[model samples]
Target chain A: MTSAILVSILMTLVAASTPILLAALGELVVEKAGVLNLGVEGVMLTGAVAGFAVAYSTGSTGAGLVAALVAGVATAMVFAVLTLSLTANQVATGLALTIFGIGASSLIGAGFVGRTITRLGPAFPEALSGHPLLRAVLGHDIVVYLSLALVLAVSFFLNRTRPGLILRAVGENDASAHAIGYRVIAIRYAAITFGGALAGLAGAYFSLALTPMWADSLTAGRGWIALALVVFAAWRPARLLLGAYLFGAVMTAELQFKAAGVTVLPPEALAMAPYLATIAVLTMMSLGPKSGRANAPACLGKPFSAS
Target chain B: MTSIITRRRFNFGAGASAAALPFTAGRALAQAPLGVGFIYVGPVGDHGWTWTHDQGRLAVEKEFGAKVKTSFIEKVAEGPDAARAIRQLAQANNQIIFTTSFGFMNPTIQVAKQFPKLFFEHATGYQRADNVATYNARFYEGRAVIGTIAGHMSKSGQAGYIASFPIPEVVMGINAFHLAAKKVNPNFRTKVIWASTWYDPAKEADAAKALIDQGCDIITQHTDSAAALQAAEQRGVFAFGQASDMKAFAPKAHLSAIIDDWSGYYVKRVREAMDGTWKTGDVWGGIKDGMVKIAPYNDAVTPAARAAADAVQKGIVDGTLHPFTGELKDQKGVVRLKAGEKASDELMSKMDWYVDGVQA
Candidate 1:
């Protein structure tokens, strides 16, 4: 209950939430564009490994972040080519991509395993961020700020901009959007590419900012959690931010409470709290007046083969 | 001794399993190297539990040279899936397969029944069949040593334990560590955080950070990763590496490590199989037998801490001190072991309760 412990808990929560928020926000855009890409897990793994390997080699965390973006987009492009270009089953291809990511990352990460690197440091200097109370908000690295900013940018792009409206139009009714000369396929492609870049960044956050090391499946299936988050937020970027931080708080609280030596519940039950909360909230979302499914883009997951 | 194989069926079913062994010896005599297969729950590069087992695999290859062919399937999740992986090794003509994970117990037993002739060694499992054996290191002995170090070096009087599960093996380690630390500092407390998974770096790091932030100055983990050590390093807290020496991962924070040395056991077991001496039984090797070894003390480990840790290791090896000794009590003040008595293997094997001063 000390202020120091509380601050530490806050710090851990933000760090834990930022990566998922980034990935969820990216997936939110993808889903909004009427493309249901389930390969976020695989794409994130490729980004994590590529990020760690590049950062370890170049000794520049910046270069590592760039590599992660490129790797993520590249792997996402594979899904795009198969699903978007060839009109394959998105669900099956997404699962296959995850399996491929697991194997490929392990093979590439073999060398980087057992290796360590300089972790991303706070963006602000100690003068401002070192304050115990202020540290909660200011001590975070660049990704934390970037995630919040992206949420705003994504919200604006989807609602305020003309291109955003066209993109949403394509998702809502692709054939109609195509009839209106919106180039539905091209807009969807761009949205999918943007989503991949963000997911890749999120994966890099895990490798470079979070653990600063490489291991097989290092993202630990957080990509799937990000995918769930898109649904949890009903594809709203701002709500996605809320959901990610909420999930992070629950996850961190589970560990922090145990670390504080408070026996509120058995360890198993404590470990299951975040997951139970997720299921409960999702159920509520489904039963609410505005059913979450109603918010889904009509053409979502449907392969378009305009004959 | 081949007496470890505890089956007396004179029936054809038993005879068929026994018949498979002679075929293995015959194939070896026919100039075919003994095919040894290993299945790991984590990647070999984990630098922890599976990494140590993989090292043993390399040792087997080194000891036998061309007389043995070793192959491994890494990152095999333990479940029905593990059975498939184990069977794939069996189908590939591997004479002896090592399934190295606790969760692989059922799958290992099931696969051994099908490959009645093929020998299977499952690590840290309780089950054994005619073709299935279990072998494990006395990792508690290593824990006792590190716990002693934590007792002497910990300024916070609180140490963090990053645990993987509630199994006897993990619980035994927690009790051993808490007991040893309490022997040095009677008021010492251990905080245990069950991570559920053995090898998730992100979660492990978070657990370590939570503990360190909560004022647990010393961190020790039973999980199979160096992530906790790295977390402790970031926070400038003392830590003990698990399974392997991870000093390089956290040079400043690493006080010592409980190293799992399986190379000697693997070499001996492989040799036994080649000489037609393989049998199904349980083998629990400790410091005395070199199955568990303590790493060299870091410079940061004070002289007093080093002396105390070394004394604990020596006592365990010489049988002068037992971790689960006289007048032990569970957290609820119930005496589990009375004065002048020691815990038996059966008690340790099924240990599920936490000891006094252990907040798990």
Candidate 2:
């Protein structure tokens, strides 16, 4: 392949991976705090519509990003209240949230259909971003850089920081953390809210940066893929980033091959590449080394009540 | 929900009372305004396939003001869920129902059997029964028009087509586009990328970018989102919209569009149902019937390209140009049609092979 084609492929890969990486990172933190929020899909949808609507009406992409974060947090709060406060079943609530998100986002985004907005542009100056080779590294929007920074920040917080240690303690053993007066429920709530915000930002990336248009189900199950990425990464932020890019590469390969007139496989088979890779990686993780699976939070998916 | 139940019960009770009268009186009682229902496979907010159908539904409301009442359930899945939704519409006393996707064919037939008195219209489907009528637009005609324009404007002679699936309808479009482009420039090459979905914006955008990266100067799509057009606009390539006008999303990159206009057919069908003249038949209307409309050309298109596109559209409408005319060959160099003949609807409906110069 020519350098130009390679650059284009890498750019598309990054664009595709950023959203899932952002969402997966948030889910990693939520799971680390001993909560399994299955409502990521619904929350992301809410964020997507909220972001597009605000951006379109106000003519400000920044305001749109903020709205998306708030919407995602608000949607997550609904899940938090039902599963955390009301002691509802986490799996059932998460699934219900997804259904609710699909319906609610479509209803909310009904008016914004067919509307367009100025896309989120590059973070660097035109001279630097416009160069052929430099453009590959500098041409990405601000969210792409932010997503990478979040991966590093999250990695540090979970390992080096005191609060991070305490949060991990809460996830590892909520009863012990509660006995130590760590406010287990409150920490878990905070983690869930933070996760929701990141997920919202990821969703906003879809409307404000990725395609810059609003359509029903525009995220198109990428939220579910993000959920899968968390599992594939074994709930680690660093691994989550790697897994997102791997998935993005697999997805981009299908388009690249078809565009290049490579007919080694039918288009149908090519389209299945990403999902096939996901299953294969998950299988390898299970059948190979046990360290990855062993890293999963001990109290993950278990609802805790101090009373 | 309770109010709907109460209304249904009242309608049933009234129908029972009306049925108790003589046959002629019962027929007169059925004249209490035609109730029409529509079931969409996707959300109306898709702004493409489902949106066009919803527009047709709105036209029905406008055309028959007080004479008809219409309702719709959006995003109904195409399997068992479709049958349940169709049954619900039938039970609600809707005299006519429109199932607006090929996936709804069997479900529509199943529900039609249960409610023999109700009329059912299935779009882009071949199946029909005593109460079910099939309707579709010749979208390939629109494809040919845009292909002609692509031929004139494309400097590289490399056009990219983003397809949703490998269904015969989509295959026909790919073949039609390739044939028309080749007629203008024999060396014209077209690339086909299947996104395997009808409405995923992210995937559609990626496919468009991939096509543009491979040196395609023009892009066209069968997917139901404006993402491809937006991608083309961002990448500085030309594209044509599918199913609906998408000029607002990509003003500079959008050369023109093929809009599905179902208003005329919808109004006529509703009138027929109300007049007790509804019949089961297949209706495949194209440019002549005004079912398929090409949007206005962009100023970016050269005058020569615009004239060529107009000529092809006029020929199709006037029955002079056959998009699937004779002397055609598949990608394998096997002759599919002999000279001095036009492709019949039956052959076109089942087209599965690509034409020469189309890279699938």
Candidate 3:
């Protein structure tokens, strides 16, 4: 294959992986804050529909993206109030939030379906962005760059900063953190809401950039893939980036090979490739000492009460 | 998560259109309108397969006027949940229900037995029972025409087929498309990328991009989305739409679309059920029956390509053409059909191998 083919394949991998990376990065922060929200898929849909609707109505892809983030944050707030403020069962409420997102987005998106808008443009000028080799690094839309920057920001926030330490401490032992004068529920609410906003952005990438149209459940279960990716990454931001890209490469390669009239494995097997990898990573995580499970938030999925 | 189902119930009489069927008005006014139920696997807004079926449902409403009330449940999953949904409609006084997805075949059959008095029509499935009937459109008939265009128009002598799965329905399309392209340019090649999904715009677009990058300039899809067409549009290539007229989605790239017209058959079947003539059987309607049709040719199509495509379309309708006529060989050069012999419905339904020059 020519270098052009290789470059194009790499480009496809980036497009396919961007949304998952954004969602997983936001989720990493939420998990690091000691909360487990399975509503990533639901939140993404809510964001996707909002983004498409706004973009279509205002005729501005930029407005659509802002609407997606705002909608995502708003929707995530519901989960926050329920689980953090009211002390509802985190798992059940998260699941319910997902259902709410799905139904609500469908209802709201009914009129916007089949509508198209200008796709989010490349982040750089055409001359440099479209260059044969430069395209690999600069060909992406704003969301792609934002996603990468967010990864670094998230990784730094978790490992190198004072508040990051406090947040990590809260996740490690909420009771201890509370004794140290940190507000456990407040920190969790903030984390969950941030996760919601990112998930929304991820969903908008589908409508605004990927396919450039609105459809119900347009994410098509990618949010679940994002959730699994967080686990696959062992709750680490850097690993999340690697896993998302690796998974995207496998998926894009499946189509690229078939389009090139070749196949290394059965299509069905390729479809299940990521889940198989996730399973292998999971088994190794459990078997290896402190490499996998050791990294999970201590207070993950557990509800906290100040009293 | 809470599942989202776009439920559209045509309760209000279709206003003045109801006046067309006045002959049955007195009897209809004396009783509740016949309850017609439909469940789709995708949103009506899909503007693809489910959208066309929704059009059929609307035709039923328009034809029967106040004599029949139609309602549909969209985004229905084809699983154990399907059986529950089917039963929900059955028990809700739906006299005749249409389960419009292949995966709902078993559940439709199962529910038909439990409600033996009600009629059920399952699309794209062979299963049948006393109260159940099967029906589908010959999409490959339309494929042959598009394949002709692909052959004459492609600069690379290659076409891309983004398929949903390796099911016989899909395999037959790949072959029919290739056969016509081969007839035009014997050296024409087809690349098959199984998307393994019925509807996913993002993945569909990705697959189309991959195919275009690999030199297949002419794109066609068995998957139900205009994303492939849009992708081709962005890349300045040619593509055909599936299940509906999608020229709106990709005005530049769209060569044409294979429209699924279920309105006539749906109206006929509903009329038969009301008249006590509905029977348990299989119905495969094609161009002859108006179940499948090609959209208008784009002006970009060379006059010769248009003429060849029209001839095949007309021939299929006149019974002078068969997309899978004899001398056909699999990818391995093994003859699947002898010259001058048309393929059997059974063979087409069970086709599992690719035709010569088709890379699967």
DockQ, computed on Cα atoms, for candidate 1: 0.54
Q: Chain B TM-score for each model?
A: 0.90, 0.92, 0.92
Q: Which stretches of candidate 1 lie over 4 Å from their true place?
A: A270-278, B1-30
**Fnat for each predicted structure, in order:** 0.71, 0.80, 0.68
Q: Against the true structure, what is each candidate's TM-score?
A: 0.93, 0.94, 0.94
Weakest 10 consecutive residues of candidate 2 chain A by summed lDDT: A270-279
What CAPRI-style quality would you assign to candidate 1?
medium
Error of 1 at A172 (Å): 0.8
lDDT of 2 by residue, A157-179 (tens): 99999999999999999999999
Q: lDDT winner among the candidates?
A: 3
Residue pairs with backbone overlap in model 3: A99-B1, A99-B2
- Report the CAPRI category for model 2: medium
- Name the lDDT value of residue B132 in candidate 2: 96
* TM-score of the A chain in model 1: 0.95
What residue pairs clash in candidate 1, if any at all?
none
Model 2, runs deviating above 4 Å: A264-275, A288-293, B1-31
Q: How should the candidates be ordered by TM-score, best one leading?
A: 3, 2, 1
lDDT of 1 by residue, A42-90 (tens): 8899999999999999999999999999998898888888988899998
